[model samples]
Target: MSSLTHTTTPANTPVERKATRSAGRRTSPNALLSKGVVNALLIVAAFYTLMPVSWLLFAATKSDRDLFSTSGFALGDFNLFANLHHVFTFNDGIYLRWFGNSILYSVVGSAASTFLCIATGYAFDTYDFKGKEKLFAAVLGGVLVPTTVIQLPMYLLATKVGIVNTYWALLLPALVNPFGVYLARVFSEGYVPNEVLEAARVDGAGELRIFAGISLPMLAPGFMTIFLFSFTASWNNFFGALVMLNDEKLYPVNLGLFMWNSVTQQQPEYYSLVITGSLVAVVPLIVAFVCLQRFWRSGLTAGAVK
Candidate 1:
């Protein structure tokens, strides 16, 4: 009665604690709305990205009449096999020749380009030279320049060298990929540690041996990445092939397809062949990426880790 009994009360009761947790667990309306919007945008982006490819897949399966009359995305009379037969047998199987040439240019040109880039990049990274930085800066400048700007000049040079309209015209120009060199240099810096090279040197290993046995393994991923990039670029090099080559026998698939597509306006029968040829032309690229994606991923990861 005289004084208040000194008593302590809990800051929060069980009911209040439960209510607090419920409030904490509940997501705000704005957050849910934002999440839904993000998901919707991604769905729309995916559909937009894939729509053309889907249309191409369906179009390649249709006959000329069906290609024009039927819905662009709908399945037609299942003429893919028939169209492929035509693509292979048409014009004395010229498509096959073009396909072979495409493979030749892509494989040989990309392989050689990748090797040269590796060696050059490794040299720049490992060895001290008088004007290394300046040379590399020049290469970077080349990367910024557009290929189209130099196509005419390259053609003129090819003509002067008497390699115009030849396979060398196509292959030689492709071997000098500035971007590939830049990428390889970056990869070498990350993957090839100096200590390892020094150890090898001390242990009686020559530069070539150290590079071939040790450095090359670590740089495998980089090599694969460069090869894939060069291959794709060479395969799709339409303008360069157009300007440098006139011989139908040396034409890559891109120029060959462009030639077919140009005539499709007057010769409507070439429509299915063109579509089918394009579909076939891209299969190898798809296969290549699928096969080498693991190596590419590893290479990227190695760079990140290093």
Candidate 2:
């Protein structure tokens, strides 16, 4: 009787094992195919995005004569140093002045913008004031307004104020970043808890003290993100510089590069300088993004969890 029972059990176990194996087999092909397609698309997209950057890097190393003649992907004569030398030494090192202007505009403008955004955002998120919703909606509307559409009017206003050719034109306009305000508002809502603010108040801390001591540290990641965005925007601003700055001394790198490109049409040698200048100009932004990427990611994910 025990042998007969064991035989029946073996038969039941085989049937169960076969059923489980068949279920797994049914799902495996579809799962494998989906994963394969996703990976393939990602690889293709990555190549497409990287191709232009790769060309720029290799193009920067080539001499003017070889730039058009050489294959886009192939390495030409390693003339990167020579090109940089030309870029720096041309017109009494004017490119260096442009670089300096860009740095000043980006750093100072972005810092001011970040501070203002933080203060305003904290107020909007933490306080309930008269017409607060209306004011915020107005700000959101301002964010949707195309910057280029306003550039002409901004330039006209600057011209009327007689600050068009000065650094004020660039710096002043950049300090009022609507997007930075929007981002800061979103970040502050997530980072600065109402309960924490109330607790700080209960502890007899003043509003300013509470913000500085408790909220600012929590908003550091958001501040970094705003700084990066404002800096990049200010650094890469072309139209503002083009319309406002007629003085080459006040021109940022983007405008300076544009001027060089304009000359390239008449003088082919300027092409190399333009390419090299572009490569150099982009390096700082790349370094900035790489260094602050962790902070940026943290800021984006800050309110997502809790």
TM-score winner among the candidates?
Answer: 2
Residue 87 lDDT in candidate 1 = 93
Provide the lowest-lDDT 10-residue window in model 1: 297-306
* lDDT of candidate 1 at residue 101, scale 0 to 100: 96
lDDT of 2 at 236: 81
Task: Supply candidate 1's per-residue lDDT for 216.
Answer: 87
Scored against the true structure, residue 112 in model 1 reaches a CA lDDT of 95
Q: Report how far residue 254 has shifted in candidate 2, in Å.
A: 1.1
Model 2 whole-model lDDT (C-alpha atoms):
0.90
Could you tell me the lDDT of residue 35 within candidate 1? Answer: 92
Question: C-alpha displacement of 218 in model 2, angstroms?
Answer: 0.3
* Model 2 misplaced regions, further than 4 Å: 1-27
Q: Please, what are the lDDT tens digits per residue for candidate 1 over residues 1-306?
A: 597788887989899999997786677687788999999999999999778778879998898899999898899999989999999999899999999999999999999999999998999999998998999999999999999999999989999999998889989999999999898988999899999999999999999999899998889999999999999999998999989888898898889989999998899999898888988998899899999999888766656776
